[model samples]
Target: MGPEWIVVGIIAVAVLFGAKKIPDIARNVGRAQG
Candidate 1:
């Protein structure tokens, strides 16, 4: 989609998990895929 949609998705994730945990959540997700 567009850049606007990308930003919205990021915001949604941040809201769902809170800013402090986003990086940790991303790391866990990457490890799971790997």
Candidate 2:
């Protein structure tokens, strides 16, 4: 994929996952994995 596609994907992830919720999910997943 191109850089444009990467940007779009990032925007899509931010919208779908959300800025506030993503960090919490990441932290939870990190804790579980670690």
Candidate 3:
């Protein structure tokens, strides 16, 4: 794979993880409050 593809893959993984974590963090906070 080229360097460009590697960079794209890293960004994709970061985006996916960020998207997944936001909801999970909100849920955890909600549970803590309640």
Candidate 4:
């Protein structure tokens, strides 16, 4: 994809999950992968 798509995806994630929730989401993702 393009840089514009990346920006849209980030914004969508922030809107759907909230800015404060991202770190917790990442932590869970990492734990799952481990």
Candidate 5:
């Protein structure tokens, strides 16, 4: 259930945000994590 929900959430995010901006968003998230 947990992993499936995570996959679904990722798909939802990709659909909502579009593929082009994903890398940049991920980079920003990585920076925030650090």
Candidate 6:
């Protein structure tokens, strides 16, 4: 949709999981899928 929604989604994710853990979790998920 729009950039505002994108940003809101990001903030929601960051709040759900701390910002520091997001990158690590993403990297692990990528590696597992790849």
* lDDT against the true structure, each candidate: 0.94, 0.84, 0.76, 0.93, 0.91, 0.91
Per-candidate TM-score against the hidden true structure: 0.62, 0.53, 0.47, 0.62, 0.82, 0.57
lDDT of 1 by residue, 1-34 (tens): 8899989998999998899999999899899999
lDDT for 8 in candidate 5 is 93
lDDT tens readout by residue for model 5, 1-34: 7799988987998999998988998999999999
Tens digit of lDDT per residue, candidate 3, span 1-34? Answer: 8899978975786687786676776678799999
- Candidate topping TM-score: 5
- Regarding TM-score, does 3 or 5 come out ahead? 5
Worst 10 residues of 5 by lDDT: 1-10
Q: Which digits, one per residue and each the tens of the lDDT, describe model 6 over residues 1-34?
A: 8899988987998999999999998898799999
Error of 2 at 28 (Å): 9.8
**Candidate 6 runs further than 4 Å off:** 28-34
Candidate 5 or 3, higher lDDT: 5
List the RMSD of every prediction in angstroms: 1.6, 3.3, 9.3, 1.9, 1.1, 2.3
Q: How close to the true structure is residue 10 of candidate 2, measured as C-alpha lDDT?
A: 63
User: Best candidate, lDDT-wise?
Assistant: 1
- Please count the clashing residue pairs in each candidate, in the order shown: 0, 0, 0, 0, 0, 0
**Candidate 3, poorest ten consecutive residues by summed lDDT:** 19-28
Q: Give the TM-score of candidate 5.
A: 0.82
